[model samples]
Each structure stands twice: as C-alpha cells, then as structure tokens.
Target: MDIIERFLKYVSYETTSNEESETTPSSDKEIVLLKELVKEMKDLGLNAFYKGGFAYGDIKSDSNKSDTIFLMAHVDTSPDASGKDVKPRIVHFDGSPIKLNENRALDPKVFESMCYHLNHDLIVTDGTTLLGGDDKAGVAIILDTVEKILKRGNYPNIKVCFSPDEEIGRGTKGIDLEYIKKDTDKIYAYTVDGGEIMGFSYENFNAASAKVIAEGVSIHPSIGKNKLINAMEVIAEFHDHLPKCRPENTEGREGFIHLVGMKGLVERAEYVYILRSFEKDELESFKNAFLESKNIINKKYNKDLITVEIRDSYKNMKEVIDKHPYTVDIVHEVYKEMNIPCVDWPIRGGTDGATLSHMGLPCPNLGTGGDNFHGVYEYLDIDEMKTMVQIITKIMDKLE
Candidate 1:
C-alpha cells in the first residue's frame, strides 16, 4: 500500500483520546482504528491480536533472524482539539499558496516560515479539525515498511506494536513484555514518534501530575466577610503564590508548573497540573517546591484552604538510553549512511519510548516529518515521510 494512502485512511478514523476517561483506551472511538490495524496486520500475513478489546494491537514480525526488532507507534490522537471529521488537503505545489478557503489559505504567512514547502507536495488539514498526523504518519510508515519487508523477505525478526490512548499519556501502561520472547536480547527498538524533519530523539521529560483541592465554608455573599472563607478565593490565592518563573513564563528545556485543568467554586475547587523536566533532580525539586508552597498556604490560611496531591507519572529515559548507547548509535549510523542529517534532540514531552526504555527496552524516537501536530494547522512532508519509510527499510537492513 502507498504510505500516504495508508496515512489518510488511518486519520479518517476518529481516535481522539480523552484524558478524563477511566477506560483502557480513554475513548471508545480509538477502538475503531485499533481494530482496523489488527485486521490490516493479519491481512499482511503477520501474527496479530487485539488485546483488551481493541485497546492495543500486538503483531510479531515474521523474520528468520534471532535478534528481534520492534517498531512502535500510537493510535490515539490528541484530546486537546477535535480529531473528528478531519478533511485533509493534498497540494501539488503550483508555486502559490494552497487555498484552504477564501478566508484561510494554507500559506506560509499565516503558518509562518512555511515557504520551504512552496516547491514540494504536502498533506494538510482543513481549517476545522486536527489532521491527526502526529502518530498516524508514524503508523503508516511502520505498516508500509512491514508490508515491504514481508514481500521482500530475508529480514531480521520484527515486532510491531500499535498502542492506544497515547495522546492522553497512558499508551504503554499495559504492554506485556513476556510476549516478545527475546526480552533484553531484543537488540534495539525505535519509536517513529517525534515531530518535524530534524528527526532524532533519545531524551524525554521526567513527568508528574498534581491535584489541589481547596475547601471552604459556604455563606451568603453579604455575611461571607469574616464568617466564611471562599474556596475559590483560596485557590486563587494559591495560584498567586506559585512562582512566577513557572509555566506562565517559560519554554523549551526549562521545566515549569503547568495549570492544565481547574474547576468548582465557593465550597471547593480542584486544580490539575503537570510538572515536567529533563532532569530527575530538577523535576523532584520542582515537586518539592510545590509541596512547600502548599504547606505555606495551608498554614497561612489557617482554614485548610489547600490539600495538594502529587504523583510521579514517568521518568526521563536518558539513564537507560545512555547505558545502551549503541541503541541510539546504530540509528545515527544508519541515518548518516542514508545521508539524512541526524541530530539528537530533547523531547519536551513524553513518548511511549520513554516508558519502554525504563521497562527494559532502550527505545528512542525518530521523526515521520510531521509538523504542527494535534491542531488544524497540522501537516506532513509527503516526500519526507516517503524518505522516512525508505530510511526505516535501510535501518532494518543494517540491523541484519
């Protein structure tokens, strides 16, 4: 199958995941695509199964070699925006901006610095919804590469995993390593899960999630002065006390406290936050600082206006990747051989590879040349994606 065709078809499925859902996939819609992948994998003559009712797809690669290679990609789109009814646009580069509409044009002026794509064919989203290229592109590349390998034969043993609900962050929690057989002997795993064409990643954030609950006494607004404490006010006060150096004023490589979600009123209000950093100690310090802030607020308010809860989500993968340097070295060598300039970059966000690395697979992420992921502005360099497919083919050959 053509990779672009596969990508378009995959995105056509509404797999946008919800972070609030308690289910395995976080969204029932994700199953629609997961099952489709299971069907496709089986049709390609690979041993495949959909575990937990389409929460994920696991397929064993058909290769004669003893050392196994695993390729991973997520099936979930971001819940930050709508992924439903996505209408993708394909441009043939006629030397002018591809008009998405009379009001909106797929021009570099609006997308800013997109002039580089003026001469190349590209795939973009309609103005209404996200294109879902983030991992769909990754999915297409993996599936197409697998089909090619199966047709060509004589390839090393391969394992393909299509995980669900990755966009909301629980993508790899249920992964069963026992099925892979070779365990640590599985040479090197790669996640085609990064963004843009610069395409190399071996480090990711040490992450944590937090919840703050503020309780107050409800009273009439006129009598609420000294007779009652407003929980919303307490929460606002807590927010005011948080460091200014936090998310409100930081970016790239610099960690911060992000206020992700907040709700409720006078009686009680809840605040949700995510703490991120590439350094474990730094993340820890950031968490500790929040704890200290909580303590100070509780004491100062004298009414238990705040209760802070914190939990570690995932750790940075650098420690494991650094130990198995060759896991990354092999990929760099392959990229160099293919003449694609490779540069190791830090992932500001997390990937399934981050969790897998700590789970005994030193997997790093590579790009499928996707940009502006998870929003209507999302697009992919079709040529770069094709190049990525060819690169994966070469990487598999080099592994042998």
Candidate 2:
C-alpha cells in the first residue's frame, strides 16, 4: 500500500495506550489494530506474528542469514489526548498555513516548526483530537519500506516489531527481549519514534522517578497553629529548592527536575517527580540536589517527616552507541545520500532504544516527520514520509 493510504488506514484504529494499567499491552484495544497489521503483512507475503497479544512481526529476505536488522514502531497513542474517532484531513500547502477545523489555522506563530512542511501535503486533524501520527506515521513508513524491499527482492533479512503502550512509557515492559534474541541473529535495531524528516538521535536522557513523602501531624484547626505540622508547606519548600533555570523553560539537552504530580493533606502528603538528563553527572547532580532539599526539609520540619524514594527508570544510550559507531554512521550516511539535512540531538525524553541499546542491542531513534505529538495539532508531512521510505531502501542497498 502507498504510504498515505497505509497511514490513513493505520490512523483509523484507536490504539491509544493506557498508562495506569499494569497490563503489557496497556489497553487490549490496541490489539485490534495489531491484528489488522498482522493480516496486512501476511497479505503482503511476509511472515508475521502477534505474540503475547503484542504486535510483533519478523520479516526475512529471500536468503537466510546469520545477521538481521530490526525496525520498530509503537502502536498506541497517548492517553493524554482523545484518540477516539480521530478525523484526519489532508491538505496540500503552498506556503499558506493550514487551517484546522472551524477554519482554525494551524498557526505557525505557535508551532514554528510546522512551517518546515510548507510545500508538502500534510495530514492533520480538525483540532478536536490527535492525528495519531506520533507513531502511526512511523508504522506506515516502515511497512511501506519493507514492502518495497520485499518487492525488489535484493534486500537482506529484516525484523519488524510493533510495540504497544509506548506513549505510556511501558512499551517494553511486557515485551520479552528474548523474542528478538531467539528470533534473529541481528544485534542492532532502530526505532522509528522521532520527529523531523532526516532526524537521527542516539542520546537520550538518563531518567529516574522520585516520590517525596511527608508525614504531617494533624491537629484541631483551632489548635493547629504552631503545634500542627503542615505537610503541604514542607512539600512546597521541597519544590522551591529546585532551581528555576533547571526546568523545562531551558530547552535543548538541558537537564530538568520536573514535578509530575503532588497531593497533600494535614495527615500526610506526597509529591512525585521525574528527574532527567543526558549526562550521568547531571543526573547525579539533580539527584543530589533533591536529596539535599529533602535533608533541609527534614531538619527544618520534623527530621522524620520527609522521606525520599528515587528509582532509576532508564539510562542514556550514548555509552552503548559509542561501542557501535557503525549504527550512527548508517543513519548519517542515509541522510547525506538522500540530500536531507541530518540533525543530531539528545532526547529530553526516553525511548525504547535507550533500554534496548543497553540490552545488548545497539538501537537508535529515527524521525517520523510528525509534530505536536500527543495533542490535537499532531500532523505529518507527506513528502517527508515518502523520503523516509527511500532512506530505508537506501539503507538496504548499502547493506548489499
């Protein structure tokens, strides 16, 4: 199928993943789309399988080989937005900004990057819901590219994986990495999970989640004066200790300590934080800063009032990618050959590649040409999507 046609069909399914659920696939509804993709891959004369209710397919070349390449994309949208009944509208632009539904223009004033797609046909929404292009675009691109490779009959072995609950950050949770290990001899893979046409990323944040719990001594409001310990006040102080310059306000490779959630009461209070950075030293500094803040709060308030829990989420992929320089060269060469500007940057966020790269597999992130992900203004450039297909073909040609 054509890229656009594939994207249209992929977007039709509401594969929005759930974060709260403990299930592997997060939401069982995601399988609805995964099964469809399996059927489509089978129809294309490729070997496909859906294991553990997750959409995972392994496509091989005509010749059997000891090595392979893995191409991966997620199947779920973010639960933060409405993924149900996504209405996609296609428009060809000639430098004029696209107007969403009700004539609401996709103003470049807000999303300046939207202008990068000025001359291409775009698939956008009517502003009520997300376009699911955050990943469906990647899926379509990979499928289209694989189909072309299969048709050409000269490509090497290829492995395809469609993971669920990526938006919720559990895309790799239930997935057995052994599947990849047992299925193929390839130790390298690439996740098509980024934005921009020729974008390539190997550096991602070393992430950790922290929960600060404060025990408050509840007292009668009339007698609650100095005798009562206010947990909320202590929590506020803990929050204030974080430097303003260290927040998301400072963008691009900068580390930040983000307050993801907080709740407080007289009896007790709790606050959740996500600490992220590209450098391990920066991550350590952030953690130490938080620990110091906790100590300060404990000394000022009740020494036992504040307790901190810091858990490592994922680590930066740079160290692993450094060992496999060929993977980086593959990405850079593909962009150069296509004459597309290749920009390398560190992801403030995390990806499946971060964990996978550490798991004996060197995987990097590739752009999907989508913007404003996880929101109503999500969109994809048609020309860029096609270029991605060509890049994949180029990668295969180089392999041969």
Candidate 3:
C-alpha cells in the first residue's frame, strides 16, 4: 500500500494512551494496532513480534556489514485529544480557508504554517477528533520505506520498533536496548516523530511533570465565617505563582510551564503541569519554582496543606547526539542529496529519541510532514509524507 493508504488504516485504530492506568502500556487499545503492525512486518518477511505491548521487527541485510540502521515510531496518539472515530478529510488548498466541520475551519490566518502547504493536498481532521498524524505519518513512512528497500537490495540491516506510551513519557521503559545492540558493531537510529517534513532535531526539551495538591477546610457558608478555606482558591494561588512562561508565551529554545489539567472540590484540589526547556539548568529552575510556590502557600496558611511532586520526563537528546556527530551529520547529508531544503529545527517537546539516546542508543528524530499535532486542528501534507519515504530510503542506502 501507499503512504496515504497505510496512514489512513493505522489511524483508524483508537490508541490513545492513559496516564492514570497502572498497566505496562497504560492502555490495552494500543496492542490492537501493535499486533497489526507485527503482522504487516511479517508479511514483509521481517522477523517481527509483539511483546510487552511493544512491537519489534528485524530484517537482515545481504550486505556483509555489521552496522545496523534502526527506524522507530510510536504507536500511541496523544491523550490531549480524542482519537476515536476520527474523520479525515483531504483538501486541495487554493489559498482559501477550508472548513473542517460546522464549528471549525482550517484558516490560513490562524495557522500561518499552512502557507507552505498552499496548492498542495492536506489530510485534515473533522475538528471533532485529532487526525493521529503525529506518529502515524511516521509509521507509514517507515513501513513504506521498508517495503521499497526490500524490493531493491543493498541496504543496511534494519530494525523496527513501534513503541507505546510515548505520548506519556514512558516510551523507552519497556524496550531492551542491550539486546538490540548484541550482534551489531555500530547502530544508528532515527525516530520519525517530528513535525514538518523539512525539519529534523537532535535536541529536545529537558522535560518534567509536576502534580500539586491543595487541601483546605470546608464548612457551611452561613456558619463557616473565618473557618472555611476554599481548596480551589489555594490551587489558584499556586497557579498564579508560576511564571508567565507558558506554551503560548514561549517559542524556539525558550522554556514553559504548561498547566495540563486540574480538578477540585471545596476541600481538595489538584493541578498537573509539564515543564520544558532546552537547558538542564533552566529545567531545574522550573522545578525549584514549583517547590517555592508550595512553600509560600503553606507559610501563608500556617499549615502543611500543599504537596508537590515533580518527576523527570526526558532530557535533551543533543547530550548524546553530540558525541556521535554522524547521527545528525548523516541526515543532513541525505537531505542535501535529496535537495529537500531541510532545517536543523529544535524540538519544543520531548520524544522517544531523547530517552533512548541517553540510554546509549544515540537516536535522532526526523520529520513527518505534519503540523498542529495532538489536537483537532492537526493535519498532514500528503505530498510531503510521500517524499519523506524516498528520503528515508536514501538514508538507508547512503548509511550503508
């Protein structure tokens, strides 16, 4: 099948991960699609299997080389939006606003990135659900490239993995990297999970997530007078103490503290935040800010009613990519050969590559020709994805 056909089929599976679940994958639905991927890899004559809610595929090259090139993409969609019953629409852009549904339109004025895709076909969502283009597009690109390479030999040995929980920062927790490197002298990898096909990243944010719980006393309003303390108000105080560096306020290498979710009652409330920065020191400062806010609020109330928990997500992949310059240099050479006009963009968010690289695998990320991922306004440029398939094949041939 072609890239478009493969993408449409993959996105039809509802694989939104659950962060609250205690299970290995955090969700069972991810396995359904993962099994299908294993079957497809087997059909391509790849030694593929699904284990621990992750799928792995291996192909041995006829070339007498011990070097292996690994291509990876996540199988789960972001929990920020619904992935169920996604309705994908294809629009041939003509420099006009395109309607996605009754209440939503893919307006060029709002999304200036659409300007680059003008006069090209775009695969968009129906405004009610995310199109799952984040990594599904990456999956299709890898699969398509694998098929073509199988037809034409002389490529390096390839390893494929479709990891789960990448959306929730648990992508590399289940994989065995030592085993993947057992028989190989050197391994090179690319996580096909970035946005915009012309951009790739060796650096991503040093990331963490914080959870704040506020506790207060509750009583009847008529009799409560000075005795009642609203938990929501306490949570609000914590939110206000945070710096104004939010997702909307920061760009490029700037960091941000994003309030992902909050829920509360009169007596108790909680808020979740994701902190991101390109520098390790900056990320540390953000974590300190969370603790400082908790200190101030508890001092004011004269009670230990606030609790803070912060956990590291992933570090910048550049820390590892810097050691092996070829990981990034090889990609640039391939893009130069393809005349793709690629950019050395920095990732504003974290990916599976960041964690895997730090684990001694040294993987960089490639783009998928997509934009506005993880939400209703997400879209994929049809021509860009197809072109990426060829670029990936070129990398396979060149790296060998």
TM-score of 3: 0.85
- Which residue pairs in candidate 2 collide? none
User: Scored by CA lDDT, what does every candidate get?
Assistant: 0.80, 0.83, 0.89
User: Where does candidate 3 stray beyond 4 Å?
Assistant: 210-244, 258-273, 289-310
Report the C-alpha lDDT of model 3 over 1-400, residue by residue, as the tens digit. 8778999999999999999987868889999899999999999989999988789998887787567889899989999999999989888988899899899999999999998888999999989999999889989999999998998888888899999988887888879786577677678899998678888888889989999999989999889888999999999998899888999988988999999999999899999999999999999999999999999999999998899999997789998899998878888998998888888889887778888888898998888889998999999999889888888887777765
Instruction: Name the lDDT of candidate 2.
Output: 0.83
Model 2, span 1-400: residue lDDT tens: 6889899998889988877788878788898999998888888776888887566667666765556778889989988899989889888877766789675778777789977888788888989989999899989999999888888787777778888988877777766677777756544588987788656899999999899998888899898877888888878888888666456487898888888898889878999988888889988888888789888888886477888899999999999999988888977888887788998978878889888888777889888888899889888988888888888778766663
Q: State TM-scores per candidate.
A: 0.86, 0.93, 0.85
Evaluation by TM-score, superior candidate among 1 and 3: 1
Candidate whose lDDT is highest: 3
Using TM-score, give the best candidate's number.
2
Give the clashing residue pairs of candidate 3, or none.
none
Q: What C-alpha lDDT, on a 0 to 100 scale, does residue 179 get in candidate 3?
A: 56
